[model samples]
Target: MNLFADMRAVVISALDQMVADGALPEGLDFANVAVEPPRDAAHGDMATNAAMVLAKPAKLKPRDIADALASKLMDDARVALADVAGPGFLNLRLETGVWAGVVQAALEQGSGFGRSDMGAGRKVNVEYVSANPTGPLHVGHTRGAVFGDALASLLDYAGYDVTREYYINDGGAQVDVLARSVYLRYLEAHGQEVAFEDGTYPGDYLVAVGEALKDKVGDAYVDTGEQVWLEEVRDFSTDAMMDLIRADLAALGVEMDVFYSEKSLYGTGQIEAAIADLKGKDLIYRGTLEPPKGKVPEDWEPREQMLFRSTAHGDDVDRPIQKSDGAWTYFAPDIAYHYDKISRGFDELIDVFGADHGGYVKRMKAAVSALSDGRVPVDIKLTQLVRLFKDCAPFKMSKRAGTFVTLRDVVDLVGSDVTRFVMLTRKQDAPLDFDFTKVLEQSKDNPVFYVQYAHARVCSVLRKAQAEGWDMSDAALAQVDVSGNTHEAELKLAAKLAEWPRLVEIAARTNEPHRIAFYLYELAGELHALWNRGNELPELRFMQDTAEASAPKIALARATAIVISAGLGILGVAPAEEMR
Candidate 1:
C-alpha cells in the first residue's frame, strides 16, 4: 500500500537489471540509493539519487547512468515519466491509477493506513516525565509528558514494542525536603501554626498530605524529632506526591507502563552491580576530576572520587560516579537504572529529559554504551521549556504547585486534546508558546482545530451522503472507479497521502513525534484546499450529480479522514467527528 516504497522497489529492481546488462558494476553499494518525493512537487512524484550515488562507484558519468536507469524505469507501465534532472537526479511521475489505488488502499486500511513495521517489533523503553516526586508535575514536565507519550505511541504505530515509563526522583534530597515540608503541615493540621522555610516546599498541595498523615497516626509523631519520623514521613509524602503526579498525568490521558523508583536502586546492591560491571571493564576508577571548563561552582574544589571513563565512549570528559565522601553521585543511580533497562532485554532505550538536563546527555549515552558494550543505544530527547500565555499576558503560577503552572492547571484551562496537540506543534527541543487565546481560536492558526476540522468535515460529507440515500460505506467506495479522480487538486491530495507511510518511517527512525503533528497539519491543509476548490467546481465536490460519480470523490475525502485519524491517534489526540 506504500506507493513510495513500491516505487523504490521498482527503482531497486531496475538497478539490478542494469547490473545484469553490465551497464553498472556488479558490486557497487546501493545502500546509499534512495527514492524520495521531489523537493518541488512540479518535478515529479518521486526523485531518486540512484544514478548520482552509483556513478562514482560504477566509474560512469552521471548522465550516462541516469539515462540508462530512466530507460529501465520507463519500461514499467507505472512509471509515466522518468526525466533526468540536474546532476543525474531522476524524477519520476507515476500513472494516475497509482494515486487512485492509494485512495482505495486508505479506505481499506482505515486508521491503519500509514502504520509501518519500521521498528520490526523491537523492544523500546520510553522513559519520560520523571519529574521529582516532591510535587505535582509542572509546565516543563507537561511538555515532556506530551512529547514522550506521543513518541511512544508513534513508535508503536511504527511497529515498535513501546513501554511508556517514568523514573521517580524519590531517592534524592528533594524528597527529604518534601518530608520536612509535610512535617510542618502535619503540625499545622494539629492546630500548631508553622512557617514553610527556605529548604521546604510551601505549595498548598501538601496541605492535604499533611492532614492525611495526621489522620493515619493521630498524635504519634507530635512530640518526636527528625530521628523518629524522617524516613516514615519521607516515604509517606513521596507516595502522596506520586499519587498527585499520577492524577496530573491521568488528567492529560497519559498512562505509564512502569513507575521506576530511583530509591529502589539505593542500598539494594543494584548500583554496586552496575558500577562493578563498568569496573570489570576498567571503566571505573578512583581519580580526581578536572576543574570546571568555564565558570566553576562556588563550592567547587578538586577532590579524589570514583570516576567513569565516559570520554572513551563519546563524552567530552570522564564523569564522577561517587564522591570522596563515599556517597554515590546522581549519575551513579542513573547508570544503574539504564543497566537495569539493558538487563530487562530492551533493544533500545529512550529518555525524555527536560532541556535543563542537556548537560547530562552525553554522559548518560556513554554509560548506556559501556553498560551494554555498545549493544543497546540510548536516545535522549530533550523537551524544551513551554511558555504559557492567556489574553496576551503571561499565565500566572499555580497556587497548588507554588512557583510554576502545574500540568493539571494547563489541562483544566484547555482540555487534554488541545493541550497535547498544542504542545507538539513545535519540536521537542524548541521553545513553545501555549497561548490560551490563540490555541482555542477557530482558525487556520490553530493547528489542532484545523486538523480536527478536516476529520469532522469528512464526517459531514458522510452524513450528508447518507441523508441523500447514497451508500457511503468504505467497501462501496473501494469498489468504485476512483481513477476518475484525475483532477489536479485531487491528485495533489492523493500525492500527499502517499507520503504518510514514508513520513512514519522517517519519524520513527529519528524518534521525533512532532514530525507527525507537522505532517498532519500539512495534510489537513491539503484536504481543506480541495474542499475549498469544490466551491467553484461542482464536479470536484464529494457530492457529485450521481451516486456513481460521488462514490469516488467521497472515497478521497474518507481516505483523508482515515489518515488524519491515524496520525491523531499516534499523537494521542481524539479525532473530532463534530466540532463542538
Candidate 2:
C-alpha cells in the first residue's frame, strides 16, 4: 500500500540485477541509497541519489553509474521514464496508475491508511505533564499535555507499545505549602478569616479542597500545630489536586496509562536500590564539585558530597546525589523514577518536559544511560511556552488559578478540539501564540477549521449522493475505476495521499508530532485545491450528470476524507462532519 516503499523496492531490485549482470561491482553498499520525491514536480515524480552516493564507494564515475541504473530501472512496469539527471541523480516518472492506486488504498484502509510498523512493537514510555500537584494545571502544562498525548498516539500508530504516563510531583516542599494553604481555607470554612502568607498557595481553587477537608474532619485539627496534621493534610491536598488535574486532562480528551507518584519512590527502598545499582557499577563516589564559573556568590562554598559520575555518560559535570546534610538531592528521586521505568522492561523512554526544564535533559539521559548500561535510549522533548491572546491583546482569564491561566480556562473558552489542534500547530521547541481571535475564525487562515472543513465537504458530498439513491458506501466507492482521474489537481491530491505513510514514519522516528499537523495542513490544502478547481471545470466536480460518470470523482474525495480522519485521530482532534 505504500507506493514510495514499493518503488524503493523496485529500485533496489533493479540495482541488484545490475550487479548480477556484471554491470556494477560486486560488494557495493546500497544502504545510503534513497528514493524520494524530487525537489520540483516539473523534474519528475521521484528522484534517487543511488548513483551519487555510490560513485566514490564504487570507484566509478557518477554519470556512468546513473546511466546504467537508469536503463535497468526502465525495465520495471512502474517506472514510465527513468532519466539520468545532471551528473548522478536519477529522476523517475511513475505511471499514472500508481497515483490512482494510492487513492484506492486510502478508501480500503480507512483510518488505518498511514499506520506504520517502524517501531516493530517495541515498548516505549512517554512521561509528560508532570506538573506539581499543588494547584490546577496551567497553560504551560496544557501545551505539554497536548504534545505528549499526540506523540503517544503517533507512536502507537507507528507500531510502538506506548504507555502514556504522568509523574505526579507531590513529594516536594510545594505540597507542604499546599497543605498549609488548605488549612487556612479549612479555618475559613469554620467561619474564621485567615490570611495566606507569601509561601502558601492563595488560589481560589484550593477553597473547595479546604471545605471538603472541613467536611471530612470537622474542627478537630483547627488549633493543631504543623506536626499534628501536616502529614495527614499534605496527603489530602495532593489527592485533591490530582483529582482536579485528571478532570482538566479529561476535558481536553487526554488520558494517561499511568499516574506515577513521586512519593512512592520514598520510604520504599527504591531510591537506595537505584543508587546501590549505580554504586555497584562504580558510578557513585564522594567528591567536591567545582565552584560557579563566573563571579562566585555568597553561598558558593564548595563541599564534599555524594556524587554520580554523570560526566562519564555524557553530562557536562558529575551530579550530586546527596546533600552535605545526608538527605537525598532532587536528582536522586528522578534517577530512581527512571530506574523503575527501566526495570519495567521498556525498550525506550521519552520524557516531555517544559522549556524551563531544559537544563535537566543531559543529566536525566545520563542517568538512564548509566542505569541501563547504555542498552536503553531516552529521548527528551521540551515544549516551549504558549502565549494566549484575545482581541489582539494579551489575555489572562484565570481568577480561580489566581496567577496563571488554567487548562480548563482555555478548553472552556474555545473547546477541546480547537485547544488540542491549536496547541500542536507549532514545533515543540518553538514558542506558540494561541490567539483566540484567529483560531476561532471560520476561514482558511485557521488551520483547525480548514482541515475540518475539507472533511465536512466530503461528508456533504456523501449525503447528497445518498439522498439521490446512489450507493456510496466505502465498499462501492473503492470498487470504482479512478484511473481516469487524470486532472492535474486530482492527481496532485493523490500524490499527497501517497506521502502519508512516509510522513508517519518520519514523524515517529524523529519524535515530532508537529510534523503530522503540518502534513495534514498540506494535504487539506491539496484537497481544497481540487475542490476549488471543480468550480471552474464542471468535469472535475464530484456530482456529475450520471452516477457512472461521478463515481470516480466521489471516490477520490472520500479517500481524501479518510486520510484526513486518520491524521486528526493522531492529533486527538475529532474530524468535523459539518461546519458550525
TM-score, each model? Answer: 0.98, 0.98
Q: How would you encode candidate 1's per-residue C-alpha lDDT over 453-523 as one tens digit per residue?
A: 99999999999999989999988887878898988999999999999999999999999899999999999
Highest-scoring model, lDDT: 2
Question: Which sections of candidate 1 miss by over 4 Å?
Answer: 295-299
* Model 2 C-alpha lDDT per residue in residues 235-325, reported as the tens digit of each score: 9999999999999999999999999999999999999999999999999999999987788899788899999999999999999999999
Best by TM-score: 2
TM-score of candidate 2 versus the correct structure, residues matched by position: 0.98
lDDT score of residue 478 within candidate 1? 78
The 10 consecutive residues of candidate 1 with the worst lDDT sum are: 395-404
